[model samples]
Target: MNKQEYMNCAEEELLHTYNRFPVVLERGEGVYLYDTDGKKYLDFAAGIAVSAFGYGKKEYNDALKAQIDKVIHTSNLYYNTPVIEAAKKALAASGMDRIFFTNSGTEAIEGAMKAAKKYAYTRDGHAGHEIIAMNHAFHGRSLGALSITGTRHYQEPFEPLIPGVRFAEYNDLDSVKKQITEKTCAIFLETVQGEGGIYPAEKEFIEGIRKICDEHDILMVTDEIQCGMGRTGKMFAWQHYDVKPDIMTCAKAFGCGVPVGAFLMTEKAAEKSLVPGDHGTTYGGNPLVGAAVSTVFDLMEKENILEHVQEVAPYLEHALDALVEKYEFVSARRGLGLMQGLVLNVPVGKAAAKALEEGLIIITAGSDVLRFVPPLIIEKSHVDEMAEKLDKVFAQIEA
Candidate 1:
């Protein structure tokens, strides 16, 4: 069907959760997406950082096709070879001891929260067990993840969320220390805050968190859903700081477009929390999702994706810096590697909309930040194309 027809059908049937752009993407290749009307646009959003290998990579496609031919899924009750392989690779990649696969990032967050709380409950007897999250942090939309999310507007609508979740200022060790009580069970923060406008954690801040977690026995949970899997030129963003989280939640690019996510924990936390029947998922680590995940990791290794991201990321940051310099309304550029954001004095949603009209796809992180989370395979040429389109869009938008 045509773009208009697809959009009309979507409006008629689909839930209105997203204020979607007036475009229906039919297919994608490399860093470009084609609309149903055959219009081409550079995809800087990377399907919100899920399409890491970019759309239609031969290796990724082949792996999924091969797996589909063999078997799609079997219940988690029986062992799946692909599931074992995927879990091994994921554990190796993140340097975490144990993993529990889930269907999405929100599920990962929920699982992490449960694991942390359960561990605390084992010792603290379930009384006053609290979680401290950061101000401006965005974990997920589930009731558990939403409780720890710091934004009031998102939480205010769903009143009386899971209790004992408190917010602290991001990057401020003092604020975190102040929030800590004897009842505190875990401290969860994003290694790089994505939806809160691409803020990378300071080295001192992460290190301090590690120290506090050590001293107080609080689980340090880092949500790496948006910034992990070589998006930040490393296997995980926490590696950049040289401080490890006791538990980490990863997704988005984890399955390379397949629906998969996981919560990984250190051996200590793993042994202490979530005994066999505490939590489970039917499709979490089934053969289908497992194949997609293992293929992503295999391709990352075979293609040297981490090195490519490291090499090309500077070009992206340089181009974004140029925009910050040229546009008076553009205030700053911040982020690690390809997961960058251009802070705007104007509304970010307006700027992104304009870029979409000019054959470019960008997204908003917070209220006034344009997020640039392109595919890891994008080269200097694609960066130039994105910057050029963004420049035109910036010129059209008022401060």
Candidate 2:
């Protein structure tokens, strides 16, 4: 279909749920996308940080196809080989004993929250079931995750959310310390805050969370949905800090584009938390997604994905930093690895729209930060193309 056809379908027939860019992505390859009009654009957003191994990875395709031929969905009531194997790989990589798979990132957050509070309640009592999250942290859109999102805009419309939730300043050790009372059950945070302008957790702050959780006997949960799985030049972002969360939630790039989410917990935490028949979904951990997930982890091991990011990230960072010098609108560039953000003096949405019109795909976060989350397989040449297009976009932005 053409762009006009899609626009008509969207404006007339579809629900006004998303604030989308004025373009229809028809097809994609590694680091590039074709719009409905056949215009090729340098894809820097990577489907909002989902296409981990880049578009059209043969191994992932093969794994998925093989599973599709066998069985796609056989209700979660019985055991399935692909799901079991995938669980093994995901659990091993996460450094946790047990895991519960879900359909999306929000479901993963809900499961993690339930497990955290359940474990705390089972251990002592229900009074100590409070959850403390960071300000500007984005977990997911589910009611449970939204309850602890710490963003007023996403929470205002849906009031009377989950109880025993409080917000603390991100990367502030003192804020965390003051909030963790006797009622605190889980102290949740993103290893590298993705929607909070790509701010990584300070080492001292993470270590402080670990110490405080230990002292209060509360659960430390890291939401690595966007920052995990070699995105930050590490398999898990928490590995950058000297902290191992009692529970961890991850999704987005886990299946290399397939919809899959997982939450893992330590033995003590898992023991008191989830049990058989306590929670599940019909499609969660289905064989098809399991095969794809197994393939992704296997490739992550053999290909040394993090090492590749370590080599290529510096060049991309330098290129984006150079943009700040050339364009007055770009204020700063910040992030650890591939998940970098371009903080702008001008409005990020306007700059992103300009980039889209100029044959580039980018995203915007809170405030004026333009997000750049290209696939990890992106090379220096792709980075150069992105920089040139984004430079023009920034130059055209009204300052």
| Backbone Cα, N, C clashes tallied per candidate | 0, 0
What TM-score does candidate 1 reach? 0.98
Writing each residue's lDDT as its tens digit, candidate 2 over 264-290 gives: 889989989878877889898998888
Q: List the residue pairs that clash in candidate 1.
A: none
How high is each candidate's TM-score?
A: 0.98, 0.97
Best-fitting candidate, scored by TM-score: 1
CA lDDT, every model vs. true structure: 0.92, 0.87
Q: Which whole-number lDDT from 0 to 100 does residue 42 have in model 1? A: 92
Residue 254, candidate 1: C-alpha displacement in angstroms: 0.3
Q: Over 4 Å off in model 1, which ranges?
A: none
